[model samples]
Every structure is written in C-alpha cells, then in structure tokens.
Target: MLVASLTAVGAQEGPSGITQRTVFAPFDPTQRGCHKPPGLTKELAYVQENEREFLQGVNHGLEMAAKDRGLKYLRSVAENNVPKAVEDINAYQAAKVGALVATSSDPTAVSSSLQRTIWSGAFVGTIVPPPATLLLNAPQYATGKALADASINYIKSQLGGKAKVVLLTQDTMEYLTPRFEAMRDAFAKTPGVTIVADIAPTPVNKEGGFVTMSTVLLANPDIDVVLGGDAVVLGALKALRVAGKDRPNQFLGGIDGEPEAVSEIKKGNSPFKASISLSSPVFGYAMGQFAADWLDGKSIPQAMDILPIALTSENMAQYEADLENPAAVYADPIRKSTYLKMYGNICYDTRDQYVNFPWSSESSK
Candidate 1:
C-alpha cells in the first residue's frame, strides 16, 4: 500500500504474503566530502518547527533519552523556514554539538543546511522528513492506505458508505501527500460517497483546520466524514460542534495519535473514530538513542521502517504506556527491535553513505 518512496527489504516473501524487506545497507563514510571530527561531546540538540502534541512527545523523548544517556540537551524551533533553519543549525554546529535530533516540514528546502550540519561532524537524526544521518518516517503510501482503510471501514459501519467527506490534506510535504491520495482512492469506488470539500489548509494546525472547515461547512453543511492529521481534524471537530453539527452519523479520523484525538476516540460517542498511531515518543526515543550511538562511533541503523499502529479504544492503554514511558519499552530487547527496523550499523566512518535527501533506490549490500 505504501509503495512509493519505499525501498523494500528485497523480494523475500513469507507465509503471510508480506514482503520481508532488507532496509539495512553497508555504508562507507571514508569517501565523505567533509572532514572527520573528534569524539562525541555527550550532548544533543533537538530542533523542530511546530508545537503540536505530537512534537511535544518527540521532544519529551529526546529530553528523556538525553537524561538516560547522561547527555546535556538543547532545543530550538526553526519556524519551518529554510533560511531560518539554516542559520539556527549554523549556530548549533559552531557550538560543536555531538548530535542534532530534528524534523522538518520541507526537507527539500532545508537539505543544504542539514547536509552542512552533518558535514560539520555532528551526527544528525531526522524524523518524518529527511536529509540526515538517521531518517525516520512511516512508509507514505502504506501508512496512508492503512489510515484510509480505517476511515472507509468506519464510513461503511456507521454512515452506510453514503456521506459527504472533507479531506484536509498536508500534500506539500511530498512523502505525506500520499496519505490524502490514499483517502481519495479508497472513497473513489464507494457509492454515495461525495467529497464536498477537498482542501489544503495553510498551517496544517488547529486554527488552520478550523478556518478551512468553517468555510467548507458553509458551502456543504451536510458533510459527515472528515479526514486529516489530529491537529486539523480536532480543529474541524471543534468547528462542527460549535455549529451544532457533531452528530453520530458524522465520522472523522486523523493520523497522529494526539492526546485530544485519542481522548475523542475514547469517548466512544464522538465523531472522531480513529487516529493512526505513529507512536511518537517511541520513535523519538529511538532516534535520540541512535543519535547518541552515532556520536559514540557505533554503527547505527542505515534506515528504519516506522510502521503505523492504528490506535483505538482497545489498544490505547498500551500505546499510552509506551508513549508515557519509552525507556521502559526500549529496555526489553524484543520490543525495542519491533519499534525500529534496524538495517546496518552506521557511523561517521560511513559518512559517504550517510543518507542524503532523495535516498538511493537501492541499499548497498
């Protein structure tokens, strides 16, 4: 389902018809364009743009992991601007940080800046959007389709597959656009399903979602199905409730397992039915640990597969536990491996293979 932008583990099929992928590859950093650096400084800096509950989980894990590893931590917001991020990273590199844990809305726009940060001898880690030594994101096409399946299933179970839909998309972030496309594709064949308002909210936040949905409701008040990330969808839900449109017939779903979205689903009576759980804190902790490992001259996962876990009432308890305490989960050897798919050990010695944006089609054996 998540086909595009994915480099599968190779054509190794198992009993379940699932392709067991080889996401790991041997990296040779001796051919790097940048010079080498001294040992790790036992310090990492976390840089992000937005202030969503999802990112809050990430930063929380980073802070926790920094504490676990006995490392000092620094953090800053880049405001989602390429030039601003460039300048911010320049400041961090100058300070000689050992690792930089980061995420970006536009990896393409900030590619040069990130590459330079890695070149400055600081091991860089990225989530969702890339161009770093360590990159993490749910496989777009697959994760999107999975979320769509949940929404489509909900529509069939509750709304008779005949409902007006609103798709709030984050299509500008290249990898994430496929999720909205999956939603469109899933509802395409279903009869009586009408997509009244298909829009791209500017900020992709609660306010942006509220503003967009308000206008959409004015045009198509009878809309019953909504889809997008937690922030926007929750915002849309607020807008709907304010207009007295929060009915049982209406169904909504989001991607991130934001606290509010999960709470809405837990209500067992709200229009919000599902939010595809990305397990933010779990992955965030993994990224932080990997960042420290790279700085320690240890080989790290060449690539990782962050599979989506659909969060519902039945599974929310454990997911919340994992979110609240990632270190405990990572303590279990088996559970740690399940959270992250490690390919190969990577370090500065493999800087040449230190992933660049628009990752290679093939993983080196």
Candidate 2:
C-alpha cells in the first residue's frame, strides 16, 4: 500500500516543479553616458551618455530589488542599439528559459521585439501584452487617463468654467493619440476644461523638438494648465522657464518623477503641481519578489499586476528613503538581509526550511 501511495504521489508530481531560468535583457543605453566610446560623434556620445545614466539608475534599483528577494537574475545587453533588442530576445527564447525583459528605450522597438520573439515563443511566448505594462511605471495608459480625468475634474470645479488646458506629451503620435482621445472623452462633460492643444512629438529629436515647441507655444499663448504625459514635460518646463513664462500661475503636471524634476521642485523654481513616480527601486523589489515566488512554486499573480502608488512632494522623501534601504521599506530586515547575503547563491537548497514540506514534516516528526 505504501509503495502504491508513493507511485501515485510521484505521478501527481509530474513536471509540476519549475526547473528553467528567468532572464532580464534591458535595452542598452551605454552610448548615452559621459564616457563616450571611441569613434562616436560628440553629439551622439552625449545622447548615449544621457540615456546610459537613466538606464543605469533604473538597473541599480532593479538589481537592489532582485538582491533583496533572493532571485537569480542575469542582465543581458543588446549592444547594437534598439534593433539589437530583437536579437537578444531571440537568443533568450532559444535558450528555452523564461524571461522578464525590461527597458527604458523606445516602446516601438521593445513591442516589436516582444511580438516576434518572446510572445511568439514556441513554448511560452510573451509574459505581458503589447506596449508592455512594465514600461510607463506600471500605471498604464488606461490608469493614467483615469487619474488625469480626476485631476481635470477637480480643476474644473475650482475654476468654475473658465480654465483652458493643454495636453503635452513627448510620446509619438502613434502612442499618444489614443490616450488623447480618451482624455477628450473623459472631459467631454466637464465644463471650463478646454484642451487647447495636444502636442505629441519626439522630445529629444532636434528638428521635431523645435517644430513642436514652436507650434504649441504659438497656438496656445492663453493656455492655463499644461498636462504632460511623460518626462518630456521636463524639457517643456525648461523651455517655459527660458521664455519667462510664469509657472505657478499656469498649472503643470506630469507622469514621471525624474530626479531632475525633484531637484527643480526642491529649488522652488518648478511649476510642477503634481507627478506620479514609479519609485524605480521599489518596483525592482516588487519584480524580485514576484520572481522569487514564481521560482519557488508559489503561483505568481498575472503578469499584468497593478503597480503600487504615485509619489508627490508630500511623500517623496519616504519613497526615496525606501529606495536606499528596501529592507526597511519591506518591513522585514532579517529576511531581506538573508536574501541579500545569499545573492546569486539563492537556490532551492538555500530556501527557508520552514517553507519546505519534507523538512517541516521531518522536524515535526
């Protein structure tokens, strides 16, 4: 009877346990750093350096999270620029290991790569849908639209039907158009909220930047509130400052919490009324936690998990401190320390014995 029971148990086990690996391939922005690689033009080098700094900051946060959660993480680089991301994805998929790709690059490239490689995987394709919820700091367009609507409504109630608002975004037309439409619909019934303009341009492109900024400023001189969809708002703020525009009188809000933006606010020269920050390090920790759970046979929530919160002046310090010490943020110093101490050595054997069945049973027996 014991032999029969053992056989039944083994049969039930089947391939239930996960044995593969999880990989992270971030879009390379090495060219965006100040240490320009040889043979690159000065202009190209600066762009690369800027991109590199942003991406490195993101990776630092992600790495801290992974370390705190005892996740076996590997970083792959797509060195041939945006186009090379697809090649990296193909290579990762060919290895037949599960992966969680992250990026701070153009969404078009990231989406295309995901569709061709990760999503089209012979075994398990993409983990998340197109436009990847991972980008834009978790609060995807739908959520962003809702928040914008609420904010706009509040403005309308306060203004009493005499406010003109302009929506500004650095996203390409293909990305921002739909959200613009949604915002339009959301404000259709609200009074005193006129969307004077919807400007969607490649913020970093020299020619595009000049044309878009000129057009928006010329067309909407009387615009009251400026709603920014992305970090490009920072560029807009800088431009507005140069033009001697009064920011406090003209409300400004955006979706990103870039460090520079925080600095500007701290200096009391910012027109930014509010912003939603993804708390990059905190996000990294969450990803790490999910990765650890998935690896340990604990069912992971759907890939499209709702991101936590937005940060504002009121609570930015708390979030910043948490990024510095995720253990304190996670509220379990011992567990966090253990996970960090183990780092790349984390494995089934190192997992807490209390969480393992045979060990727990044996201890009890």
**Candidate 2 lDDT (Cα, 0 to 1):** 0.43
**Deviating ranges (above 4 Å) for candidate 2:** 1-58, 69-72, 77-80, 90-99, 104-142, 146-161, 170-179, 203-211, 308-310, 326-365
Which candidate leads the pack in lDDT?
1
User: Which residue window of length 10 is worst by lDDT in model 2?
Assistant: 353-362
Please give the CA lDDT of all the candidate structures. Answer: 0.73, 0.43
- lDDT of candidate 2 over 283-355, digit per residue (tens): 4554455444434333322222223244456776765676566546545754333222111111212211101
Candidate 1 lDDT over 169-219, as tens digits, reads 999766677777778888897788888988888788899999999889897
- Backbone clash pairs in model 1 (N, Cα, C under 3 Å; residues 3+ apart or in different chains), count: 13
Candidate 2: give the clashing pairs: 31-48, 31-49, 32-48, 32-49, 32-50, 33-48, 33-49, 118-126, 119-126
lDDT of 1 at 180: 78
